[model samples]
Target chain A: MTIKQRTFYILRTAIKYVSLLIITFISILPTVSTVITAFKTKEEYGSTNVMTLPKSWTYLSNFVTAWKDANMGLAFRNTFIILVFVLLGSIMFGAMLAYILSRFKFKGNELIRNLFLFATLIPGIATQVTVYQIMHSLGFINTMHGYITLMMGTDVISIYIFIQFFENISLSIDESAIIDGCTYYGVFFKILFPLLKPAIITCMILKGVSTYNEYYMSNLYLQNKSKFVTVSTSLYTFTGPYGNQYNYICAGVIITILPALIIFILSQKQIYSGLTQGAVKG
Target chain B: MGKINTTATKGTILHRLLKWLRSGKGQRTVIMISFMSIPLLLLIIFAYLPFLKMFEFSFYNMKYIGERKFIGFDNYRDVLTDKEVMNSLKLTLYYLLGSFVQLALALYYATMLSFKTKGGSFFKGTIFFPYLISGIAMGFMFRFFYTRGFVLDTVLSWLRFELENLPYWLRDKNVNNMALVATSVWKFMGQNMVLFIGAIMSVDRELYESASLDGANRWYQFRYIILPSIKTIVILNMILSITGSLSAFEPPYVITGGTRGTSTFFLLMHNMAHRHQKVGKASAMALILFGLILMVTIGQKLIFKYGFTDSNEDISQKTTRMLRKQRAKEGKQ
Candidate 1:
């Protein structure tokens, strides 16, 4: 290569590395700063500059105060309950509906598929007013079951994922099962359901993360904040105009994200693939 | 005689019912209904029902609980003429611009990281970690990060910038939206990058090898090979970003509470319904927003379908075919 070409190549490589480093620094700065602030005492937070190292690295008071003041114990419990029921209900119903839609040649199948497709186009926020009214009429407002049911209700994405998975699985399995005296239900539960482990994992990861991160609907529907504080809503404790305690708020933020952070560290591969696949298909 | 006749009729009906239940058609119907009823019901009640009601509510003047007055088009008029609503709609331009920048950055990074790089996974993990964090936490982090003399200012100070010169990120109307948009871009850019990388990785390696053998530089390979291969996914991301920009909420809602000229269309509607108690007007606004989204989506679909007839084929084939045709023409010349 000519000297000009070599020099240009070096310049390009330098630009790439420098830009990547800058972007990485920007990405992690918020979390790192929050971590630092979480460890500082109120006095330290006020006196020292924001990026200053705490006097001691072993301070636990901020976390203790945040947990107790935010009622995060109840929040964690509620979030867990909601997560378990919502995941189970969504997967079971989504898979069952997908099986029928993909495997069966029933009347109105096309209509049902189109309904789901059209439903996805309507943003959920656009329908909140009437949905709230419907919930109130049904006496479901501020109820855990109501929240879970609404969450499990309109998961067109997960259903689509399941349908795509079902399409790839061979029909010969189902045909053989039927010939061996298995009913349709028997074929689904006893034969096909076990084969859906990977799809289930993908759906769980996608649906699980969204449901965990969900705030708007949870806040609106579960209005009894003190009685029903999910992890997302628990942070509101530090949100009033008079409440500007960054130390405790930072600690609460750390507490709120710990589970997700741990999960990401442990299963980074699965998380990346699941997220990419979800986006691509979506 | 009457008792005997009644008994015979009852037995006949029972036998017919049993026969029907044993039939294949009946079994299929039962299975379909049993499996689909709950999901279908939920969808109708939660999604479709509310969607249809938005239209009905748009035509009537009502609160959450009260008598309804049949007022036609007034809510639409009010929504259109409202300065606050119009300003919020205009502010979506900032988010739209942010999203485009986000896509560009994501594409650049994905291109870089798709090839071999030092500590690629570590960089990937660092960038993608923010996407996994909850938006609420991000709101808090950014609210603090942007406060005067805080994380952002401190970092700038390290670079020898004076703290007094820095603007309060969440307070100043001029740069506050930009700050919020930056937070959003930070939070979501990783997901977009991963998506682009996935698309690029799916491209065949031979094309790159051949291009490299022909003395094509990195930019040339990216332009010819990666760009064409990932066109569909890029377009899809663009469409999603456009809709997302229009519905931008969380950052402003959580951090700034839609203050300082930061409210987008969704936030406006949220305040309209919950704060102002103008359910009718909010419904009208929502329906209008929905209509806008639907029009744009259908327009995109049409453009894709008609404008690029052979876009689905591999770009490498198209390039090579064009090259061969050009060579033949030159030979004739």
Candidate 2:
């Protein structure tokens, strides 16, 4: 390579590296700030030099107070309840719709497919008012069942994914099962269920992430603070009526987010794959 | 034998009724459909039903102040003239624009990674990790990052930037939406990067090899080969990008609450429903926002012919050609 070409390459490499540095800084700055603030005492939190590190760290103390004050232990139990029902309901319904749509060539099949598509697109806010009123009327408001139902019903995306994968499977398996005297229900569980493991897992992870992260519906429907606080709302308890405790809020945030962060790191690949699968297969 | 035969008739009646449920195909359908029913029913009751109620509520002058009275279209008119709602609409448009700018930046950054360069995977992972974090978590994290993040403050000090003089970023109206948008971009960039990388990887390698052989450099090859190959993905991502932007809520909510004096459409809808108890007006606004999303999505489909489908006739032919070439090479060897 000539000197000119080498120079061109150097400049190109420099430009690329610079862009990467800028992007990384943009992404990391906020997280770094949040993590640092967790250590500073209440006074240091509001210091004029907002960019400086705390003169002292009270990591243990801050976390203890945030946890106890926020009642995160109970909040966690509530989250678990919400997770169990939401996960079960979405998978069952998503896979069920997926099974029929994939297997049956019945009338209005396309229309049903379109319905899921349309539901997924209708910015869920559209139904928030109605859902609230109906839940209130039914006396399910501020209850686990109401929140679970709300989360479960808003699962068209999962169904869409399952149906896509279901279409890819060979029909011969179903046909053979039919020949062996199995009914539709028998064939679904006995034959197709085994083949749909990947899609089911995918739906579980996708729905899991969205459900755990969901604050909108829960915030609306789960109004009784003591009875129904999830991780999202639990973090809000740190901002006491008199003033904001920076250390407490910070520690509370880290604790509140730890489960989600752990799940995210562990299943990072699955989460990305699941989202892309929905995008590509949609 | 006659007595035994009489008992068999009762069994036959039960069997006949459940024949479909007994038959493998029909039974499977029933089981699967039943599984779907709870979720779908939940969706119907909570999601679809509420939407219907919103429509019903829109036609009435629902009031907390007095007796409920029917006032068709008046709610919608009230919403239309409401200055707060109009301000929110403007803010939302700005928010949407901010989001798209970030998406474009993400796409560009993603394409750069597709060169199969070093540290590419690490870069992809680092960027993508944020998308997995909840908006609330990240919002709180940013709360500190903006206020007293250690590394950020240290860097600012090192650079001689006065931490003492730094203005509250989230509190100011001028920078409020921008700050939220930057955060949105950070959260979503990784997801978009992964997608763009996938799109780039799916492009025909021979197309790039041939372009390079013809003395076309990286830029030239990217323009002619890479860009065209990923048009469908680009269009799809763009549609998702724009619509998702218009509905931006979480980060802004966590950052400013509904109190920032700056509210997006969804936030306004939320406030209206929960705080104001103007369900009728809120529903109308929600529907209008939905209508806007619907119009844009349909417009995309019409103009770009982009909707989610796995099969692309264009890509299939290319894959076939690659397969044939590989087989021919094997035969020659």
Candidate 3:
């Protein structure tokens, strides 16, 4: 309660808050500037610095130009198709694998699990050179379905999450279902699968975000950018000829970010918990 | 009649096999095999098979196509001795340093926000927003942000600094790597912070209250209580982040195209394979990078195990013992 001690405590608290504020500002600075720039016309962008607020927030020409020029329509469509197929295929495969490995006493059970554990240690990028050749020879180059198939192949995290979840669900559920004249397939699809909603959400958020943000493989394997343009790769349409066109580029960038931003804002709770749970299990 | 029936039944082996297929044991076998086969197959084809192929390709001089020369160990030697490859690896150290900086910041903020703080959730969300963004968009955003006379320069000018005084963030060799690493920290630090926060929140609250009842300060409490509790997760996160930095890509590849000496190992390997058509060399470089990452991961675990041998020490007793010593000294005085 001494004044000197009180002053020092106040100073320390002030520093902590101020430091957090400064970092929060820095974290959002780029996105905020881009948003500001996206609303500017090319002439306005040229006349004003990047930090300047636009005169009118409703300038729609840059967005229109970026949309058409960048072929975002095709990009969104391709990404949508990829997400749909990959999510469905991977979730099914992951849940099914987790069920069998955990529920049934089978031969080579431990061996299959070790195969995946060892696969995790292998750096994925290291093997991509060879993977590229495999895809090429299989005539999977530039094909949307091929990309989806490739995506479904990497389901390690989902399986890990599902397996962790399965440990908590009682085996009596499966036992009773089977005794009630249910096949293993029915026990899974009708009973256990529906109960896996939380785990599915975790996998969905983690896998979905990564898939949506995946640019390297999207750019590399899906080579025909025009036909196979993903939302992530579509932004690169501005890289070559219109590299300095910040107004349109920012517009394009905003367009790409809007969906993810909306989803994040709505599902912040699930995403946070899901991420923590996934991290612990993974 | 019985002999004829037996002979007929024994003769129909295919029918018996079909009958068994409909039985319970057959279904179990079928389901287990079918369920396990798909993921295991995918892992083999996409992961292990390619890993094996990459291993084989490292020994031969080849490209995406054309004739392959079995120049055993030559590619490996070149990868080891190449100055450019080694230099590209040295850039990883900058990222590693940046990542540790990131962890420290995350820990500080996690500690701050773990206690009662204003708008903690809002700050967490804002910081974590970048992680949700695609890497390509971040590259685009920072490209604009760091351009000369752009966002960064304009912001600096407000602080009474001249625009000319600032270096180009992505072009200047000295600061470019750091600049790229900053982008990564901005994008990823939030996630690490969240992880830390989650770990911190799970800690028993009464521990903090009990420590405060003693003459323990915040630093003592953190060092004795929070640090020991969250040690496993913190170390795990550190290992993961270090391994990730070894193959740092996206920022350099996207922003500067690995130009101006900003090329990290993966980006250089990418360029070598696709641009220069040196697949074998690139594969060798990849294997070498993997080995480096493996060594670093193992090295870190060893350090943690040997360096922190007091994993099972009782924090409360240690605090009380120190308190007892201080009281004894005060009594003597």
Candidate 4:
């Protein structure tokens, strides 16, 4: 390459690498700080000289307190229960809605599609009071069932994603099935549901992560302290009012996210497909 | 002949019934009308029913847990007259503007990533990593960054900025909301980038080539060829940004502990419900917040319709074809 061309190429390459390096550092900075701070003793954390290595590492005391004493254990249990029911219910309902919408032509097809699309814009918090009232009237207050139902049911985004994916399936499959005299219900339950596995997984992860991390609705609905509290809500009670415990707080944060991190690591391959496709299709 | 005719007619009716039950065309109608019964019922009862109830609750003098008295527009009057609420609203508008900046930045980064460059996959992956982390974790992360804590402090001191001299980000009322917005942007930029990148990638590259051949520069190609194509996604992102900004609870709730003295509209609603137990008034506030979001979204849709023309359809089709070819090449590697 000519000298001028080489100079231009070097400048472009340098900009790309330098910008990316800066971005990556900013993104990971928080996590790195949290990990390091978690190892310090109380005094070390609060000391004026915070950047230095802790005077001594206090091994796992924060983790223990955050896990057991701070009530994260109970929070973990509640989160698990919520995720299980919410994930299962949303996937089933969303798939059913998507299946029907993607395949069938009915009188109100356009109306139904518009309704679902419109429903997507209505912020969930907007209807919080009424939902609380409904839950209270039904005596579902402070119950796991109520928490799961509220978080998972009537999700428009998940249903939308499923519909987008379902639309891609060739109509010929349904055509042949109909020609073979299969009922619509039979074809949907037997053939179509199986074919929608990838989409199902996509909605599952999307719903699962959102539901798992959700705090506000759960905080309101699960009023009784002993009955149910997700990880985030539990943090309110974990630290006593006297002073905030940074170590335990860090531990709680880490503990709360560990499950999601594990799940993400295990199913890492499907994640990009699930997240990217869902975003694009959305 | 009569027997044959009768049999054929009977078979056709059965086939029609079967087709109604199974075909994708009829499936939406049947399924919508049939299975949608319970969900629709629940939505009406829970969603709309509560919103109506909220309207009712707002008019009364209601406490957290008590008999509500009928007071016509008194609560609305109070909410409107409260200087705190007004300040909170202004703060919300500021935060909303910050979110827009973040959204625009995300769009730019996403557009760059969508360009068929070498190492695009790695860049995209690094960018989207933050979205996987929860809001709560992100809140904690920011707390560490702002506070004098751990490794960041060392770097700051090395750069000759004394730790004690720098104002703590969360402690200052003026900068608290901005810092929260920065944290939010950090967490959300990745997700928005993914969405916009996907939208741009779905656009046809042929338009760019053609624009170039006509001696149009990169800026013109982006304006005429790229911007119009991603209108729907842009609109969607805007709606999400507005709603998400309005309903921001986690960051402020965690970092400031709602003592930032000025709250976002949703955070105010949350405090009313949780801290004060003003369920009735809180619900009213929530309903009002909902109305604001709805008005903005509808207004946005109207603006889009009036302001923008349909994207060039031929370019879109060509873009789809090019995207498929690109995907095929990736598959081989």
The DockQ values of the predictions, listed in order, are 0.79, 0.55, 0.76, 0.46
lDDT of 2 by residue, B77-191 (tens): 9888998877877776666676677668777788788786678766776677777677677766766565543444567677888867655567767776777777777788778
Q: Compose the digit string of candidate 1's lDDT tens values, residues B1-333.
A: 999999999999998887876786776778899999999999999999999888899998988888999899999999999999999988889999999999999999999999999999999889988988888888888889988888998999999999778888889888999999999999999989988988898887877776776666788788878898898889878887888988898889888989889888999899989998889999999988888888878987897888665553547688666545655776799
Error of 1 at A122 (Å): 1.8
- Candidate 4 lDDT over A38-72, as tens digits, reads 77777766674545555556577878877776567
* Tens-digit lDDT string for candidate 2 (A53-115): 667654467777888887888888998888888887788777777887777777777877776
List, residue by residue over A203-241, the lDDT tens digit for candidate 1.
Answer: 898999999999889889999999989999998788874
**Which docking category, incorrect, acceptable, medium or high, applies to candidate 1?**
medium
Assess every candidate by TM-score: 0.95, 0.88, 0.93, 0.83
> Residues B148-214, candidate 3, lDDT per residue (tens digit)?
9999888889898897778888889989999999999999999998888888888768677766776
Ranking by TM-score: 1, 3, 2, 4
lDDT of each: 0.88, 0.73, 0.86, 0.71
At residue B321, candidate 1 shows an lDDT of 66
Over B95-197, each residue of candidate 4 has an lDDT whose tens digit, in order, gives 6787788788777777666666567666666667677777766666666667743455666777898867766678778777787777777777777877777
Instruction: Name the better of 1 and 4 by DockQ.
Output: 1
Best by the lDDT measure: 1
Instruction: Score chain B of each candidate by TM-score.
Output: 0.92, 0.81, 0.88, 0.78
DockQ winner among the candidates? 1
* Candidate 4 residue B97 C-alpha distance from true site, Å: 2.8
- Mark the 10 consecutive residues where model 3 chain A has the least summed lDDT: A117-126
